[model samples]
Target: MLRYRILKLRGDCLLSLFLLTLIFGLILRIISLCRETFNHEPLSKAPGGDVEPFSLLLIVLGHSRPSSLQRLLNSLSKVEWLHSRVDLRIWIDRGSPRDSLRVAKGFIWSHGSKIVRIRKVHYGLLKSWLQAWPLWDRHDYALILEDDLEIHPQVYQAFRYLTSKIGSRDVDGVIFQRLQDIPCGSFVHFASSWAPVFSRRVFHDFVGWYNARRTCVPGFQPFVPGHDKTYNHWLRERRDVWSPWLRRYLYEKGTVFLYVGSLGMVHNHHERGSHQTEAPAFFVHRKIWPKVEWNRIQECVLQNSPVFECNNTQDGVQCGPVDGDRRALLRRGIKGFLSDKLWICGAPRAV
Candidate 1:
């Protein structure tokens, strides 16, 4: 009987231990759910109201190159003028190396910049741009820079000058870098992925058009294949034919994209790209503005009112001189030529 009693006691003890373990597991799961809920609380509820007037959103598109990304970030950090006003958002696409994500997060924390959402799934260039478009709605201006580029020291000054003139000028956006093959011009003839600054209105319009047409064309994939001449040929044709219509639309609405001639405010350092392999000779041969030259230009811009003039050599349209017959041209249609040599000559010469 005593033996039987001892066996019953042992069984009871085992049952109690099982119940205690199950309860503990349940408690841990509940705690985990609560922690997740707390971490994901929306930014709107977290003490910050509306965005600042001069707020700038810097969106960095990062892939698997942690070292390259670190260099870009370091360059940006050196720009004291930009550091305070700019909030950085680094989007780490799926399949990116774990090291890249770690580096990006560390940079953000070190800089005290708020973490923008990290993407889990891989969205190629086109889709990622589309997905990130909504972020512009919250900020006054947005600057998109790929990981492979570095900003010039005077970029912030240039941007400030542009922002100051934005109210009076019908400038929608500005490309900060000069392409190697393309001659320096105010109007962009081709679609460029180089660092471009866009105002809220420009961002909205461009993304709207992109979203509508990205899937409209059949069998035209958004991803550009490396070493595939056929794909490149198709892309060129599409841009040359269909893309101009979008430019025309923006032009008709008094929104023109502009670029600084010859004065490159950013440097492209990528050796290889998804679409094409860049020769080392290409970057070596590219003309870059020296620091002293950029300083002189900045001084000139700050001293006098910056003039927006059309470049007859370039195919795209530009803002005409403030006092010229070109105003009439703008009123009449998107295509107009200003034949005033004095107005063009009086504008700041590109170094």
Candidate 2:
């Protein structure tokens, strides 16, 4: 018994020391990565002239298709950070292919931090997406990038401009999809191959409303443009798709997402997921992307950029020209959006 206790004590000491080293080493690695990726770029200045780097948060979701995942990682590595550093959180769904885990673990981020998690139980896509994104995080902006798309080098630049430059007023989310450029920007209501990114405020409201109304999802109708169902209602039948819920939240809240249909920051590599392309939309401009004057980022203001206002239609929310309804957007806040019924819906579920 005494010998066993002695051996246990030594093992505990070694374990503690190993944990300390790992923790401290991670801290050092973060510092090193920040300097390597961020310092070389021109830092954005705060009003007080304090230097701050633009921060990007990326939530990458994958299950299988290791080659697709690898292609994405390679593009990420090649991206020009511009004024931002990345916080990459890759969450692979449960029962993922063996090659997927190996691919995720092998890739390293040049800038900022990267985390890879493989769940033990099979949660499919919806649970994995809902659970992976934390309510609180430290980043200037965030995007949910799908695994099957290859990113363009200037993708981050486009994201920063769209969200911060224009989206600051009301564009709560932005997405890339295959579309013939509509004169007015088309709102992406479902799965897009490149995927969507919700602003901090919009996402918070979505989570709040979703938690409250989750139980009512059976009867809940998504407000997406031509958002529909077959046999089982959305959340019940389509466990893999989560955007419909978000669409429901946005419809009630009356917010919108702006996307330049012609500009594909990400190219779809596979036949699966939400993409409408004979070839991915990005391929159209890939050859001239190099010659394209990035100065257009500055030239394109709210008027030129596709800004959408939601209007009620027989089908559902329709994206059209700017209308009076724009003011009704998230200005109400989550507290205003929740109701007694919604709060009641959550109570029984909590129990």
Candidate 3:
């Protein structure tokens, strides 16, 4: 009887081991499939698949700094697919002299490639993109980047995924997933355009929108919001204004809204002396401008003016041209210390 019991126990142990091996095999197979599906395969590094040609419209304006520009170029170099095929359009700031731009050209050319085209336009941070309005027909998608962003290896994958998911809709904008606001407790997800990929139709919509309000939000306005400033306000205001329209228009057109980069791989560095700068030393306190009163004032201004010029004055005295020059110096100095810090990344700094 004891011998019979031992034989039964051995049989049970063998069966358990076999089951464990089978389960392990299933897990490994699932992992392999997932790896194949989600792993980035740039066209330059892709396997036996038909190469999809992607034309890049990269714009760099006054925001360009040497360290930041170097970082941008480095990250862009990792884009395996569009190495030689990139149709770059660099719009240097008008304030940045021809000599500065020439130096920029030399810097860009040193990277084993040349910018397919270079256009010098009188554009600040926001005006840079505004200038591209006329030239939107040059590509499938427009990549509007500041000089300080270093993107991830999977940047192309994210773009392709967005294009596939969003389709050819007019209102469908792909948000390139680098955000300062933690919308939820997650590694990555999409909400809206922190860095947007503009399609042709969407570009037109932006132009139309800009044209309609361009008079109010003119290019040279001192208070013209930076990219993050615009994004934050757009998010806060879009639920009542743009979001529903986007959902209806894109959804009706069979395109879905998507965001990528939950891992924060797209790093936005605010190099000092760039076009993006914070308020003067005095504009950093909350008691000076309470949120409730500030919102009320903002609503009043938006409703009353819809578009108005910036107040480049203090104590009823014009700060004049010297203010801009002084601010430029401050901007350059701050860039080195605060390049990748969140204090100035996703939203307007207190000012």
Candidate 4:
């Protein structure tokens, strides 16, 4: 009888263990589903099934300027056209001061509906960007904006226009604006700092490449042929501490250079005293960052010279047509006329 009782007890214990295992499995599945939903969940809906499924991630550095951020927030609030177009996620550095943290929290809370989350972390900008990478998998497109940006009202319209225009085409990337002084209608295969939109395919591919090749090369070279510009840009900016495999990934398959568009969304705040001293100062006092700064960098790269000059207007330097002949260009063509031919939007008689 005792032996029979022992067998029954063992059977009961086994059944209980099985039930617990089942419950644990269910819990894990639920957690995973919630994570996926949070990451790639549907964005704000529009009528006619045209709503985009993307996340606009605003990654603000801990030491960002308040006035600049406030202006950026104001722009965000006044984005009337894209009322329900994106899911906004703001990632702020948690190691910031209490006051800054409160302000960041306040900003997130105020836009509670659109704001998916306010991730607080203790890291620098580059690290913070990596921290936000997981969220990218959940989004169709991601717009990585910094705190100190002053965007034009039509920024959203411009971004939507580019995305629709560049659908699945293997161009580098699109930027609201660029620092390089390429011809007005130059073709780009990439994007820049302002408000860049990345399809999931592009993001995954580029980041995957970046991961594999970021550290291998000693300084920076094209991960492969035709991609020298992108890799070198990182080298110039002191971010080339990646592996050779990452470099190779970025430069692979004749991905020569990424292209950019000449719309206006991102503007530098160097005049407001936020000069990125960490980066080699390329632009002079009067030139715009995108129009003049990047071109100088490019010139140096082309010449294979570590440092180059903005000597005159001919080589698309800082003193080039954009600056030297703004008024003439404004009167010369319809495109120029439409551009308002100025650095910042709505500036007083700039052209």
Candidate 1: C-alpha RMSD after superposition:
12.1
> Candidate 2's error at 67, in angstroms?
0.8
Residues 1-351, candidate 3: write the lDDT tens digits. Answer: 999999999999999999999999999977764443234234442122324444445545434354455556556666544332444445566555455456456654322223423444444444455555344234556666665566665555445433432233422444554334322112111223235566655666544544543353333111112223443344454322232223222211223233333334465554454333452211111111111222221221111111111111223211111223223433432442244242322222111
lDDT of 2 by residue, 1-351 (tens): 999999999999999999999999999977875554344445664322334434557888876667677777887887776544567788887766888888988998866667788887887655665665675464545678767767767766665665555545455566655344343244433333256666666666667776656556555544343444521244455445666665556545556566654465667655343322243322222222352345554444355443355333445435545443344344432343363234444432110
How high is the lDDT of residue 299 in model 2?
A: 47
Ranking by TM-score: 2, 1, 4, 3
Q: Listing every candidate in turn, what is its Cα RMSD in Å to the true structure after a full C-alpha superposition?
A: 12.1, 6.9, 24.8, 14.5
lDDT of each: 0.52, 0.58, 0.41, 0.43
What lDDT tens digits, residue by residue, belong to model 4 across residues 1-351?
999999999999999999999999999977865564464434554322335434444334434444555556666665544553344555556543455445555774232223323445445544555444454236555666666665655555444433433333433344455545543223332324445555455556656444543354233343323334444445455652332233333223222122233444466554221225464322232213232233322222121101111111223223122222223322333333234332222222211
User: What is the Cα-based TM-score of model 2?
Assistant: 0.68
Q: Which is better, 1 or 3, measured by lDDT?
A: 1
1-351, model 1: which lDDT tens digit per residue?
999999999999999999999999999977754443233222221012221235456788776666667777777776645334345678877877787687787874333234545677877555566565454236556778777778876676566554453341444567665543333333442234567777766677666544544455445333221213433444555532222333323333334455553566788776443333453312333324467354444432232233243321233333344343323325423232112112221221111
In model 1, the runs with Cα more than 4 Å from the true position are 1-53, 108-112, 166-169, 179-190, 214-232, 236-255, 277-289, 292-295, 298-351
Best by lDDT: 2
Candidate 3: count of backbone clashes, pairs at least 3 residues apart or interchain: 9
What TM-score, over all chains together, does every model reach? 0.57, 0.68, 0.46, 0.52
> For model 1, where is the 10-residue window of minimal lDDT?
43-52
lDDT of 4: 0.43
Model 3, runs deviating above 4 Å: 1-54, 82-84, 97-100, 107-121, 165-171, 179-194, 215-256, 273-275, 278-351
Q: Which candidate order results from sorting by lDDT in descending order?
A: 2, 1, 4, 3
- TM-score leader: 2
